[model samples]
Target: MKNFIIICFLLLVGHQTVNAQKALRVYVVRHAEKLTGDPKEKDPELSPEGSERAQALAKELKGQKIDSIFSTNYKRTKLTGFPLADKIGISIKTYNPDQTKALATQLIENAKGKNILIVGHSNTVLEIIEAFGGEKPVKPLTDDDYDYLFTVTVKGKKVEVKTSRYGASHHTEGGEAKAMKSNK
Candidate 1:
């Protein structure tokens, strides 16, 4: 009876460990650079620099098990997510920008314990992050700025957030204004 009880305990512990390891990781990124043509165009594609940035973003996310990819029905968003979707062998799903909060909530619930990737426009990316309980505000990227990455991980009711700027030298909390890197 003692040996049987010990075996049962071990099995229970193993199951919990596997479940914890499967917790979801969601990455929200802004669409890469855009074409410089007329602003009146209904849908503009990625500019040359934007295309390069998309490739760079792909390289950054390589080797991760990205289960689902979500993007708005915009050319830039679709193009930005293409490389990563191709790398992971999954198709991109389009969500309504107006219903972003609801859509993100649904996806988060459906992805319970799974990893997901979402690509959005400058105006909505930060909003999505906030919907997920992030305290950071959305900031606009300049023509020369292209390397802003938000890595959000949710485990049970706990959350962790990290930011990596492309060419900038420092980080700030809760604002969109550009700050110069500290000389130190």
Candidate 2:
């Protein structure tokens, strides 16, 4: 009977460990710099510096076992994620900006126990982050700036947030981001 009790305790501890390991790690970033041109330019491509930054971002995330990638259906976002996707051997999945909250929730659910990356616009990045219960607001980004990184960890129904910055050449690092936390 003592042996049975000890075995049950061990099993319970092991189960908790397994559950902890299943938490998701999601990285959300704004699209890299774009070419300087008219806002109405059709299908603009990334500038030379933007290309370099994209390559750098890709290198940073290489070998990270990214299970899936999400991007807006826009040229800049697509280009921004290209290098990383190529490195990870996964195709970019486009999500509608209007349905960002719903899509973000679904992505979190689908990517549980895995690592996922998302490329979003300046305005919508924070919304998605908040949808996941992140504490930090999305930082403001300019046309030439793209450095924000939001890391979300989800365990069961709880989510923890960590914010980091990359691509610092274009923008200052670290600023107060207003997070709009909501369960919706």
Candidate 3:
């Protein structure tokens, strides 16, 4: 009886360990700054600083074993997510804004326990966080605020959203996009 009890305890502990090992990470950020040109054109390309910020994003998530990359079907967003996708050898999958809720479910179902990087616009970033059981720090991102990084971590059913920053800020004259390291 003693031996059987010990074996059962070991099995229960091992099962818990395996379940706890599954961690899903979602790194979400807004599209980089765009050039001021062609007011009529809906999709503007990234500015020079935006390109630098993209590289910084790639550097930030370098070896995270990022399995999936997602972006809205737009020039600035795609450009921002490209470097990391290229570095990780994954294609950038585009999701329409209208179907973000569905996409959010698909991401959780498909990614399982891997890392995912999502590039979106200022308006949609908060929605994406809410989709993953994360509370939004701000209701909406302002046009000038491009320095927020929403790091969503999922372990089993528990989800945590930690606000962080990466790359240069889009608000500064220079110097890492001005306060790039801050969570603002």
Candidate 4:
């Protein structure tokens, strides 16, 4: 009878351990800088500086096992994630910026136990972090703030968040960005 009770106790603890071990790691960043274009050029490509930064970002994440890369359906965001995707040997997947919550939910569900990278805009980066139940709130980034890299780890009920900078700096101010590239 004592052995039976001990066995049951062990089983309970084992079950708890299994349930507590679900984890996910996510790396997110705003897209790199974009070239200035005509007023009607709503989706501009990355500037030369932005391209160089993208290469640097790829170098920074080379050793990490990135299972997936997601970017908004815009030129700048796609351009930002392209190098990382190439380094990791994964195709870049596009997501709608308007449906951020849905995308966030999909990642938490389908991306559990995997390492994922998301390229977003400055205004939307904080929202994605929050959608994952991450702690702390962050203000929106500026035109020249291209180096913010956010890491979010989710383990069971605990969500840990950290910020680190990567690549070069290119700060711009005044007026809205055109092409929805760097600023959109």
Top-scoring candidate (TM-score) = 3
Best by lDDT: 3
Candidate 2 lDDT, 1-184, residue by residue in tens: 9999999999999977786658888888888878877879866777876787788778777877888888988898899999999887789999998888897688666666888888887787777778777765544555444766778888777888887666535443454333424679
Write one digit per residue (lDDT tens) for candidate 4, span 120-171. 9888898889888996445677666787789999887689999877776432
Residue 65, candidate 1: how far off, in angstroms? 1.0
Q: How many backbone clashes does candidate 3 have?
A: 3
- Give each model a TM-score: 0.75, 0.77, 0.80, 0.79
Better of 1 and 3 by TM-score: 3
Superposition TM-score, candidate 2 onto the true structure? 0.77
**Ranking 3 against 4 by TM-score, winner:** 3
Per-residue alpha-carbon lDDT of model 1 for 58-176, expressed as tens digits? 88887667888889999999998898888778999998878977976775565667677789877777777777766563455544345677877766666677777542223445434
The 10-residue segment of model 2 with minimum total lDDT is 171-180
lDDT (Cα, tens digit) per residue for candidate 3, span 1-184: 9999999999999977775668779999999888877888799999998898899999989978888888999999999999988888889999998788898777766666788998999989999888887889655787766667889987767889997777764544331334345676
Q: How accurate is candidate 1 locally (lDDT)?
A: 0.75
- Score candidate 1 by TM-score against the native: 0.75
Choose 1 or 3, whichever is better by lDDT: 3
In angstroms, the error of model 3 at 73 is 0.5
